[model samples]
Target: MINTFTKPKRLYQEIGLRLYEELSDSRFSVGDRLPPERDIAERLGVSRAVVREALIMLELMGLVEVRKGSGIYLIKQPTDNSLNNELESTLDNDDVGPFEMMQARQLLESHVAEFAATQATKKDIIKMREALELEKQNIEVLDHNHDADKLFHLAIAEATQNSVLVDLVENLWERRESSPMWKQLHCHITDQTYRKKWLIDHEEILLAIQQKKPDAARMAMWRHLENVKDTLLILSEHKDPSFDGYLFSSNPVQI
Candidate 1:
């Protein structure tokens, strides 16, 4: 017997489809709230990031609504297959704004930085130093090394010693890599000065974490993302009118 059933291509997609089925089957009617992200993640043996991403996808499909500080609720009995079809064919870069992605990162990584600072071991700090050194070296080359930058962030997440937080950081990085919109937006923004500024921000974050200052770590992470959002907004505006649709603010995003 030849078994040909393959797993879903993406973990979040698999989780999203299963969540759709569960929502359809459950007694919870339209307007009823779904389980919390942590609850859902625990029930399914997945990371909170996986659940969060699935929820975002479902919201885009018009199957559910997310009321921040309240909860996620089922808004419609059925989702639009047209949206799904469009997603299958190609994702519209406009569908996800750079501001939106940065907002999500701000929410997750601020807390992650806090936790990593509080819980980081001596070895963890060493690993982070190594990543930082690599980032510095990579930035000098003609071709930028995104992997080194990624490693630095991942090292901070690793310091947390919480599997879920680690997963969330990794998930965010993966999404950034895979997002066409992110690539398009960055193409217009990235330059030597921008890279140098980011490296300095990374160093500030690293210093706070190494010193075991949770508050400082959180603020450092928040400020770094805020700067990133600001720069992206400026570049996005210059590149396309579609980016003007994204809400912009000089004030920092509140998580």
Candidate 2:
């Protein structure tokens, strides 16, 4: 315990360790349903997104089960050995939170879209269209790497004629690709409706750039990212009253 903060654990890891420790109490046992996300969030002094990530980590560690319509249940009793093992394996996870990543992209990419509106050439427009066509072909597939989506965004960054911007955008995408937290959270989202909306968003963004509408391009890109973040957050909401939109009616964590 003396070295708990020695490695500087990430927020989700810290929260997850605390929750896992609580499972060791006599009041908790295998098969007991844990509290709702909102309740856990409030008590932990963190947002529901943070709580969701922590829960996902716990589920990945095999300590908890998240049933879609039912609340989270303890699937295994936590032991110090198991806790330290899982903690050692995942405590080094300093990757950006999915929502946090989206926020960064929204801020940076919206401005990039605006800049692209002024710098885009016929070649760039053609590249964007090709990416869109590929995206259109893959729209119905829910479990791919989203390569076309990446190409579309990278094409916009390239339109700026700045290698630094391209590197920055590419770096962000690569980070997202490598994030374990992102993968785990995405595994819980089953809805494909949002992908179609995103394709529509890409078309709107391309059109804005083609027309050289800087403001419209920025706004379209901004709105697209906001919708994406919202959809992912909504689709990943599993367990408790929140699973079906009854976010305010779930039970609090049992002490």
Candidate 3:
């Protein structure tokens, strides 16, 4: 007989599976509030970010409800009969890891910026300028969902005049939008302060591209993404001395 519950591939999925097994036992009951994210992280010897991702998987599976600024609540029991369907739902929507997505963007877009610095025409620069302006307005209005952010990124890719690069950037965004795991990660984050820092990073990227300095543009983009990854990982800090470090490298490149 084919086992309905397949093995987990990602770190978050593995954590989610562990939690699911715990929930299946008599330890937890319906409508009960689970332990705090910090406590869970300490107990599991994993980062709170990983625990958050696992909770998100449970949320997607309709097994728990994640109330912002409050706590996760058990919504439904994880019975074997329903486990197959719920597990499939969670797996389908969370096929990609959030860190992996950011790493890909860092690699691809940094090079795209390098190419943009060389290939960008006056018209391309104007388009990028417009996107940046729109992003500024969105930030000023305190808009949590910054649709213009993607526009700026796509503009950078488009400035490269490489159709394939534009398509790749767009595809990455599409994947992020469709990802339940990504959405879940953002749901817990209430701080809007990070947007301001990213805006400054955007300006640096634009300046380097406009100057036609490929090396500067590449480094600026690389640093901006490094900041982004760092900000996200701050939530995943593990105080446990024995806890293993992050799944991805903080600084993969030397320069």
Candidate 4:
């Protein structure tokens, strides 16, 4: 029998490692404008969202700067210590509870949904609709494509025209992807009913945002995430043998 299994690393960490290798080999120089996100996605065989997440990590480490409406550009003279330290510190905090992270996500993403209701444009609405259609098709397959789910949420954040919130949500999703609890949830959540319910919740939020109903959108998103929180809490408790109570029982940190 051929053993088939895979080790897990955060998407951004993998991207960061590849970037570090390139920088070390002088494949890209300081001040060089990195290719557009789509181009990088093609080159790396990863989704544009993954590239964007990686770029955010790079930006956080001061290795690159993203200029809105321009493009990402290399910044630091290639050095190992700061970038390595940043990555290490990020990876080292692996013990943080999943519910705690979900609480943070709920607080930030709900606000973004509210802002998106007020700020989204006609173009943004169209993009959101397209994402929803894709989400509907994907959910029908009952596949656990967290990346697809993430894109739907990120599209809403992007529509908010709030770069800070967009960056924050992207980083949050990246961190969530690294958690074993999240991995376990993905494995257990194979039911089409569960998938469809999430899709319906996404559509409800999108409709509120489309109508520019800020309060409605905010509440819808809050309700949707509350469901997510509840499901995660249940799954984390039931499935993961090593999970401590914090993964399920902790209350949200008041913002």
Which scores greater on TM-score, model 1 or model 4?
Answer: 1
For 114-162, candidate 2 gives per-residue lDDT tens digits of 9999999999999999999888888755546599999999999999999
Ranking by TM-score: 2, 3, 1, 4
Give candidate 3's error at residue 199 in angstroms. 0.9
TM-score of 2: 0.87
RMSD of each: 12.7, 5.5, 4.4, 16.8
* Best candidate, TM-score: 2
Clash pairs detected, candidate 1 = none
TM-score to true structure, per model? 0.59, 0.87, 0.78, 0.56
Question: lDDT per prediction?
Answer: 0.70, 0.82, 0.79, 0.67
lDDT of candidate 3 over 1-255, digit per residue (tens): 233566777878878888887888757899888887667777998766577678777877889886544567888888767666768666544467676678789998899999999999999889878988888888888877667788889999999999999999999999999886777667656667888899999999999999999999999999998888777755433223333444343465665
lDDT of 1: 0.70
- Compose the digit string of candidate 4's lDDT tens values, residues 1-255: 121112215665566567655665677889887766555666888654355445555565678765543556788854566665665664444433344566677888888999899999998888888888878777667655656688889899999888888899998888887765345334434334666777789999999998899999988888788778776544322222332333222334432
Model 4 Cα displacement at 143 (Å)? 2.7
Off by over 4 Å in 3: 1-4, 9-11, 27-51, 65-76, 92-94, 232-249, 253-255
For each candidate, how many residue pairs have backbone atoms clashing (under 3 Å)? 0, 0, 0, 0
How large an RMSD does model 2 have?
Answer: 5.5
Provide the global lDDT of candidate 3 against the true structure.
0.79
User: For residue 49, what is the lDDT in candidate 1?
Assistant: 43
